[model samples]
Target: MRVPTLQTSRQTLDAISTRQAEQARLQNRIASGLRVQSPGDDPAAAAQAELARSRLAHIAQDQRATQLAASVLTTADGALAQGTDLLQAARETLVAAGNGGYNLVDRQALALQLRNTREQLLKLANSGDGAGGYVFGGQGSPVAPLTGTMTPTYDPAAGTQRVGENADYEATVDGEAVFMNIPQGNGVFATSSAPANTGTGWIGAGSVVDAARLTGHDYAVTIGGTAAAPTYTVTDTTAGTAVASNVTFSDGAVIEIDGQRVQIHGKPAPGDSFGLAPAGRQSVFATLDQAIALLEGNPTNAAYNQGLERVHASLDRALDGVVLARAHVGEALRGVDAGSASNQQETLSVTTRRSGLEDLDLAEAISQLQNSQVATEAALRTYASTARKSLFDLLG
Candidate 1:
């Protein structure tokens, strides 16, 4: 139905106002490079964009956390590397001191060198991250982990800090796991031939087959009987209990006891004996102390050989422990790097999606702005013309 004269002017004015408002909205979009000026523009898209933004923020936070974890691991890795070097040097010194040509004075000189190395190892053990936190601090502690002027003491507990998302490289390497509680004696079990053995029997390095069944015990393998009817017995020296008795001994036999297994690889005469002890953890500080003690002790004493053996064993385990620790650090670093790459990809994907929903398309926005301007001008001209015609008609 056609409107009355007064209503016609009002309708024209409303149409013009609507055109002007649309033109202003388009212009704003074009100038600001944004599609949604307010939630009303596209409520669903606006909500999606907000979620995308929150995801981006979370990604940024995860990136920062990953970086911090990497830094801490890097520091620990460097210190462990240094520790390995020091252990190697000490090993070389021990080997040199073992030479028959070396005199007491020479041994004493080596001792002094090892004392300095001990101090250096201590420093590495008690290393700080310069953030008022220690690299080996388990959980966290204000005091140093290793303290004391001579024979630095170790704190059994240390912190294990993890980084990253819920899955993948998020669990970080722990300090105590690396440096403090490393297994001694081949990192599994201690194997040795009897000190009183007159035969050429030997025991090879053994491994724990069943982790659950492994009972840390001191076991002695005593060989008796004739070569034809060789017999062996397993006795727990620590508990003073017998494990097995009168088992036939073979040239190469795999002995299993208390969930631990070992192989004897050489010929053994009657009265020969072999032993196995549970592997325990030791600190790098203790290894250095033993080395120093060997040099200070009487070289010709009856227990001199045993002491030397102990020191060599300790040093070897220390070196192995550091190497293992470094391996873990490297692994953690790789995890962080991988996590970083993943985060970057996710950020890119979210940003792209957000841009599609909220960012203006420059070409389309400009085109629409131009069309709106044209339409607004046309509406204004039509309104003015109709208003003038209505006045002329009324006058006539």
Candidate 2:
């Protein structure tokens, strides 16, 4: 393909041009530390390297999301821990109110202490993440999730905000379940005494004796017969049927019916009645409110004992709920940590693949670059020498 007019010179020039281009390409690769500069260099390796890079980008994005979720969950855990402490303080105050030596002034003071605890707990329930959003705000809320100073209603959406749209973990714990749906009794069933009864009797917070026989129905235990020969009867109040009748009773005897059992203490009047109902959700606010009311009432010793027992049981359950929510947050935190580790592992693997596909082999690249430089210099020298020979020998 040489031109007839200057075939020898043109051929020499073309040889130098090609050698120089190859030398320049090798130099750029060595300097850039990338062997595959373009698809033209190695199409298959280029495509695989691009895929690896895309995966790395996604992994980075996921890691960022995991970090954000961990932060929110950590905030939620701290808020719940503080709430548990507040509830513990309230329990102590409640116990103090039950003291017989404490007179009206003392009980009132104790009630005020409980009121303060309620206020503080309400604030904690509406805790924020320092980003103008609530830790207990559930999915989202324009206002505080738990409102109403007196009752403290849970008004937020039911679902918790998650780390991601499809993430199995929650960034925030379920505040409604923690604060508004606390179990009232021993986490199974609750018991109560009839207000009209004038007896020294008290009912214990009962547990399910047999799961297979659980009726999940309310029952009424009534004292019957003469005062000297008192007997107790169990009736299924929910189903309107007798569960047990004419059962012998003594002081603090355990009574069982429908797979549930409770011990009654003290002497119950012949007509005195006690009620047992399946455990139901009671708002933490209402539980505190009840304690405040009990102290504020300055009731008789008998009433104080029974009412305080109920409040104590309720508050304990409230505390348990908060602790449980805290545990859940801890679980989510662990999950986030696990996710971060997974992301790091994937990032490393992808980076290695991309390095294999496109990263320069420094020693080998340097060697190739040196060879190309030699080749380019040799071609240039040869072209100059040939040009000199052809001009001198042109006369020949």
Candidate 3:
């Protein structure tokens, strides 16, 4: 075979260029501390590195979510703790009021304290969870979980005041389990009966029951025993005429004057009357309304005292709600921690796998670089020697 002189020189130069390029690339990798600087260098390695980087980013994002969740839970826990203290204080006031030595004046003083404690509790219930939402309001935003005004009515036949929970977080806990599981009040007022009325004639009526009083009325009203023959005595005070007749109440039941509502189970006072359906969902306020009425009225009465006892029991029930809520918070915290740990582990594993697929072996890279350096040097030396010896020297 005839060898072309120019072709030999061209091939030597090409080989030297390729070796020098490889050496330069290895030096760049070392300087940058990264295996794959460009896709052109190693397309497969670059793709693998991108995948690892994406996984790391997701892991970091999940960690932030976990931290945020922890903060929310901590805030919720603190609010619940404050609520528990307020409830305890309210119970102490109730017990003090129960003491025989407390006169009506003393009872009135106790009522003031009760009102203060209740206000504190309302603040706690409406506490923000540090995330622009009420901790107790489930998913609702920017509104308090518990809210309403309270008014005093001198109705004798009412029940004691009690606090109840409303809007509970349902995402991590059962709403009913946390807010609707309050214990039944004393047997004095059957869950199905209208509370006994006080001997004092109805003091007066209002245009609108205050929000709190109305809420209490909602829980206080109940259906009593089997319906009796309905009847009505209409004394026309203005007309000065007494008329007696049988007034048929629905379901053969007459409304009793229990002071809560004018439902079929009970009749409103001369001036009092039932209004439209409740403004909001039934809640602790409703329960408390019934309880406060029961407590203030003749405490000496058995039914009244029974209602009071029930109110105390309700305190325990409310506490149970807090405990249940805390349990859910705890569970959520555990889940968040577990998820963060899982993400961390996965990130580490992916990083290792990606390193294996994309990262250069420093020893191998260093050795290859040295070899390329040597080959380029050899090529340079050969080129210089061949260029010096011309075609005449070759022929000789």
lDDT of each: 0.76, 0.84, 0.53
Q: Tens-digit lDDT track for model 3 on 1-396?
A: 223488888988888888888888899887766687788878988887888888788677666666666666677677767766777777787777667676767767776676676666656656665666555554443455444556211111111111112112122222233443454432112232223542211211112323334322232222222234333433323334443233443431433322222223233222221222222322344455555665555653434444455566555556666676777667766766677677778878988988876677888788888888888898899888876785567787
Candidate 1, 164-265: lDDT as tens digits: 555344332455665556566567787777677766566655667788976777899898888778888899988899999999888668888787877665
**Candidate 2 per-residue lDDT over residues 242-330, each given as its tens digit:** 98998988987889887887988888889999999888888999998888888889576667777788889889999888888888888
Model 3 misplaced stretches (Cα beyond 4 Å): 1-4, 37-50, 151-183, 186-282, 287-300, 391-396
Candidates' TM-scores? 0.77, 0.92, 0.64
Ranking by lDDT: 2, 1, 3
Using alpha carbons, what is the TM-score of model 2?
Answer: 0.92
Ranking by TM-score: 2, 1, 3
> Which of the numbered candidates is closest to the native, going by highest TM-score?
2
Q: After aligning candidate 2 to the native by TM-score, how far in Å is the CA of 319 from where it should be?
A: 1.5
